[model samples]
Target: MSQIAKTKLTQTQLDAHWMAYTGNRQFKQDPRLIASAEGHYYTDIDGRRIFDGLSGLWTCGLGHSVPSINEAVAKQIKTLDYSPAFQFGHEKSFLLAEKITEFMPAPLNRIFFTGSGSESVDTALKIARAYWRKKGKGTKTKFIGRAKGYHGAGVSGFSVGGIPANRTLYGQGLESYHLPHTQVPGTEFSKGMPEKGKERAEELLNLINMHDASNIAAVIVEPMSGSGGVIVPPVGYLQRLRQICDEHDILLIFDEVITGFGRMGAKTGAEAFGVTPDIITLAKQVTNGAIPMGAVAFKQEIYDTFMETGGADYMLEVPHGYTYSAHPIACAAGLASLEAITQQNLIDRVKEMSPIWEACVHQLKAASPLVTDIRNYGFASGMSIAHIDGEPAKRPFQIAMRMWEKGYYVRYGADTIQLAPPFTTEKSEMDSLINALGDTLKEQH
Candidate 1:
């Protein structure tokens, strides 16, 4: 463990600093505290530089310790740190929304802010259900997500999220349904998009057919499954899903919290897969992880549907939105982060680095203990390793632990080690990160 100086702490010491989505006991046993971060590395408490592999939970697309973003946030904090988003106006919020809409497709021009990816997902689900109700199809209330696709951890999101471990623990929520996930394990080690997705797309149609189109409100899916082992969609898959949703009057939602921004080379998963959805949920990279913010991008029709419903103009459209909705500081962070991406040409950077990224992913084909498969797209990837029964996901977890101990960090779970370097990650960092991963696998007995 890197030596960390004893720093000032409030009443919330090791006992109270409970983490989210982490192994609490294990983590407390050996805490990894980051004092600061810059570029593609994080400074330990004792000041050891550790390569950032997960991009700060897949946010920080511009990398950490961004000076411009820091400046913007600092300036905003002194100007207007807090504001009422319910019935108030803020210039920064409007500016951020305008910038966000500028990148969305026509008709998906409206934006609703939330506090996190979970909120964004739950907001999207609520919008879908409400859209149907506003259209006099109140019975169309059920939502469809795919197996292994993680939207977020909110109640409604977990209901639709296909990760059994994430959902099975939490009982019933939102009367949800799940479409078959699109992980073509047979296509492991495949390059770019997977080779077979149409069949999986059929699963959506089957669900609609069995459940009856009128009762199905929306279908939510991650265009390229990122959290659930980096499952890439197959050829003609998303388009087929589009066709099916259209045929069944099902609202389509792309949970792009992980794929949004320039993470996927293209500006969005919708653009990458050539599949447009009625709503797109975004988080993570929106403010470059500088602030906790999420957004639900919806079609003009969906917003108008809610608007035309029997409700007063001043009343809540859906009786939702956080106290921090359209928060001024978050807006400031968002505006600056978006500006950074645009000015630095980060999206284009992903495109330029994609070939090298793909090659590196496939190069792991010969990696030991025998890499079963490598699924990669743009700058994201996950490698599968054969497990020795009852120890599913253990090998990759070991690899990730070793990677961290040796000065790098990566995410491991569900039998695959996921690699999601920052969109702004330098080529040298990428090389070193991959080298560390390779070394970890090679050195493991």
Candidate 2:
């Protein structure tokens, strides 16, 4: 066990640290502290083993306490713990960039590292605007994102992100418009990519026409909406968006922060859906969630435009980057994690496990009246519950708390209970997870 895991903190100590995206008061009353994790299970403070039904917030695909990743991190700390990312170079950063491009779709070979998903989204947005400026289209600065899509929490991400609750506190973010979410009626309980909602992509055309295509710089979307309830893209939905972007000279950005790195049964959601975007924002599983890191992959033309317009060889072409961009520790973790992903053929494992995952999650629909919708793709699934007395997210919150008591860890957002187990999870573990969920639903009902 790591030294950090061995140190126990009392409730009072925990209270000093305010958690993110958590109900502070309620959590302080009943804090569920995780002690350690191994494989697909987490040991809580009480020493009870809990099934990691959400794969550490859909990030630790290779599971927790991975030896190789730990070793890489240790070696890096001993070797080069810190290095300046700006106006400097690192071997691991370069090598990791090349390794990442191997998984990205063709032409998206340019990599710019950031600190988190939020940074990646903002970076991609800035890159889009900068690229257009270099290409003599300075007025094309507007962005269009889908209503249910979630980019990240950065200022630009919150602006582009379609979750109203996330954006409500922050007054009108970047000058951005939203496409209607693709979760149309009659598509509830979709097993895979549903046939409906393809025409929803045409909303971009309407937005383009309303704003004039020349004023639009980019359209960002998650191939499969993750945080705003795992709303899978309807068949041909992304393709249609790609075509519209192409026709209108708008850059297409895919915020694959949650769906990249084999989450979609392919190297990326683009590969899974057979649609490529001009830019792809990635994070979460890039370093298997072991370190804080995010990256943006851009098309070659975008890089070429910057290079051609850049004043001199030593000039900072893109005057944007985080202080910790491509931190050596993160690069080391990413290298080790990515190597394991490729060597283990984890993407193929996701493909092999997807059907079982689908079957397991779909079974929850009949388990309770609260379950109103079930949407799934690849290894991820989201079960939306019926609203409770006008409290849309209450049922999920209650369900998640109950799930915790029942020795399972799942993510609850809005009105949905999401599941995205590790790629290393076995069918038996999946069965246990479904059974636990079934029992929870039965008790709740």
lDDT: which candidate is best? 2
Q: lDDT of each structure?
A: 0.85, 0.91
Q: Global CA lDDT of candidate 1, please? A: 0.85
In candidate 2, position 105 carries an lDDT of 99
Which tens-of-lDDT digit does each residue in 387-423 have in candidate 1? 8589887787788889888889788878888988888
Off by over 4 Å in 2: 1-12
lDDT of 2 by residue, 1-445 (tens): 4323344656568679889989988877667778899988999877889999888988999999999999999999999999998888789999999999999999999999999999999999999999988989999999999897888888898898888889999897899999999999989998999989899998888898899999999999999998988999999999999998999899999999999999899999999999999999999999999999999999999999999889989998899999999999999999999999999999999998899889988998889887889999988999888887889888889889888888999999998899899998888888888888888888877
TM-score to native of every candidate shown: 0.96, 0.97
Worst 10 residues of 2 by lDDT: 1-10
RMSD of every prediction: 1.9, 2.6
